[model samples]
Target chain A: MAETSRDAKRARTAQLILEAAREEFATRGFDGATIRGIAAAAAVDPSLVIQHYGSKAALFAVAVQLPSNNADVAADHLLEVLAVRLGELPPETRALVRSMLTVPEAEASMRQFLDERVENLAGSFDGDDAKLQALLAVSGILGLTITQHFLKLRAFDDVSSESLLEAAGGWLAPAKGDT
Target chain B: MAETSRDAKRARTAQLILEAAREEFATRGFDGATIRGIAAAAAVDPSLVIQHYGSKAALFAVAVQLPSNNADVAADHLLEVLAVRLGELPPETRALVRSMLTVPEAEASMRQFLDERVENLAGSFDGDDAKLQALLAVSGILGLTITQHFLKLRAFDDVSSESLLEAAGGWLAPAKGDT
Candidate 1:
């Protein structure tokens, strides 16, 4: 079946809102960001932001999602892709991360991202300690953000991403399920 | 050497101001925290708080220092102690961390602690990627705080500290200096 122009237009508008929300959340943090401001930035109605995502918290969850992933990507490969994607997050997305950290309003939204975006990956690991494993992975990434991204620790800046990931090799592995 | 009574009283007053500052900084964040408020909490004159430490930022640096350590503890044991200490941070110190994240005045103070406390440990690591190694360790700890402490991931709360630390085995090695 041929796709309708209306469907394409709808998708485009949603994408616009997501991008705008990213900017708003990053710059102002969750407390300072508003639906109206994001709507204005996207050139869409404020209701549309709410209509599509339901609430501010909902909007943030969708806005910070990783780029689409292949369902077929192996578990191990998925981890690599996730790590690289986390490291190379767009500036807006990174801002959203800091916003989540600093703002109280974003707490639920941050948890939503961890559950929807991060926990699914944790489950794929051969582990019963899925939540623990997932949190650990996030810990490494968050720590790296502090060093490699936010603080720009000189030693981390000097190392290639590949070498850094290689070093992260042992740490990234999910704990075995039975254990 | 024998200590003078005046010196002892001076030290006691300084300690009182520090305890008061920790509570103020934690509960109110840097922007909301005031020298007068801290002094009131300590039952001292506001000028005394200033006279003792010079400023709030300098005060925070001294108050949040980890208990104590020397080279005598094995590297692995040190890691355990460090993790435990981070886990069991005083309420005031934890509050100070949130304040640091949210307020500019607190950031410089926070950096002082990170430099005096965290980066020194980073520098002690052996390899060229010492900074990165230290950060990875921090990342894991930060992530754990978000889950176990911040968000209250119940599964994480259920796990014993020992098991959780064991699960974090590979990621926590702070590259041994000169190894």
Candidate 2:
């Protein structure tokens, strides 16, 4: 019973530290963030952070959750959902999008994610033309995400995701000149 | 004659400062960059940076040249030109593209450039749609640059820019459902 209680306590402490670390890393970047700052934010001693995560770099690797395969599926459905959700998002969400574009940690995560996608998924293409098509498809989705969500350019700021997706679906279709 | 020599000397100093600043800002970011470090890289006294640019921020704003309009053409043409230029670039140009995308100073320059495009040139579309189109265009360009050049995702690393441009032009054209 005592062991169970201790494990639970450890879990809660780790969760708190992870959340704090994510916010700090996102805002200050990998180079700028300090483990001590993360500990203070998590309401724990610096030693506790080392105990929980092993090291600052390890904590960061854990904090920025790399989007899983689930995220890829989510990305495929992004335009449809984004259009619906745009009207409902609070101002903070917009700010978050802006930060993701401007911040180094967010940018690095995005690059890493895309690199993985290209390596793993782009191989499905059969021929040179087919590969080019696959590349364009990926480029279109990535472009839409960065422009509409991250850069928050005035052009896309007010446009619904539905309209954009409808256009993308047509553009990304598997036909010559369809784009 | 002495004024010409002074002017020439100042030009060389400013160029050195700018080059050093770009390298520093690219690696360390704006907040992390210091005039002292820039001076050290340029082999000049710290006071020279202040004398030339007034402040670190001011120096940065100047060193990072934001994209600008030539005042003689439409945004569409600008996009086309960008597409062509990007397509024409050699594979070795990936380093430059990566620097543009990942560097904090370069990202800011890109934002400023896009903001100007939306404000000055994205006037063709009606109401909010203009902004949406502008955002989409920028997103498309950025996505292509990152995927093809910076990240160099497999097949894209070796593909010629002309082929990529041909693909993009098709994607950027008006949708059948739209018009």
Candidate 3:
């Protein structure tokens, strides 16, 4: 009974650490962030972080949460959700956009995430140009996200999420000529 | 005669510094890099960095030149150049592609440049959907670039520069319909 309770507590503690780590890493970046900082943000003991995640790098890998077995599904869902959320953002979201554009920590985390995606795709695809194709797809999605969400360029920044998603879905889908 | 030579030397020194700064920032990122490091790489005295560029931030602004002016012309020319370059890269260029995609410094610098371009466009185009449209265009171009150059995705990575340019050029041109 005691062991069961202890395991539950450990799981709960790990969850808290993860949430805190995501926010910290998103704000401070991998190099700038510390284990102690993440623990403090979670209101847990610093040792708990090391005990739970092994190291700062390991903690980061977990916090970033790279796309998993369902890459295509996740990518599609991300595009759809982003298109909607971006369209619905209150006027106040300008501040959020501004933060995303100017913040180094946010930029770093984003880069790390995209790089991993590209690397994973490169490994799975087999062809002379397989790696480049993977890179392009990753770059394209990232480029779109940055331009629409952060820079808020004209036409793109003002359109409904539905419209953006429609366009992105078309581009992302396999075209007849592609094969 | 001596004054003219001194002026020429100063100009040469400034150019060298700027070039060195670009490479360093592209490789090490803004936070990890230092003025002394840039100077050493440039083979100039550290004080000359301050004398020529004033500060690290100032140097970065100048070194990482954004595509702010003549968007249409720059976009067109960039596409052409990239297409040609893509066709010319040796098989070994795969490694370069990997580096660009995986490196945080490269990723941040690329995003920073794109964000600036999108923001500049947003200021010019005003309407309900103008911002969104501008953002989409920027993202599209960036996405295409990453796809073709880094990921080496099929069809795109293997095609000749002119062929790729032809496809991209059409995309960049004003859309005729919703499709």
Candidate with maximal DockQ: 2
lDDT of 2 at B95: 20
- Give candidate 3 regions above 4 Å deviation: A70-75, A78-139, A174-179, B70-75, B78-134, B147-163, B174-179
Please give, for residues B49-143, the per-residue lDDT of candidate 2 as tens digits: 99999998778767666446767656556455344444443321222233333346555565666666656545654554556555565566666
lDDT of candidate 3 at residue A156, scale 0 to 100: 50
Off by over 4 Å in 1: A1-88, A116-118, A166-179, B1-7, B64-87, B91-96, B99-135, B173-179
Which candidate has the top score in TM-score?
2
Listed per candidate, the RMSD to the true structure in angstroms reads: 6.9, 5.4, 7.5
* Each candidate's fnat: 0.31, 0.41, 0.34
Provide TM-scores for the models. 0.63, 0.74, 0.68
Q: DockQ winner between 1 and 2, please give it.
A: 2
How many Å off is the CA of A131 in candidate 2? 2.3
Better of 1 and 3 by TM-score: 3
**Cα shift from native, residue A66, model 2 (Å):** 1.7
Where is model 1 chain A poorest over a 10-residue stretch in terms of lDDT? A170-179
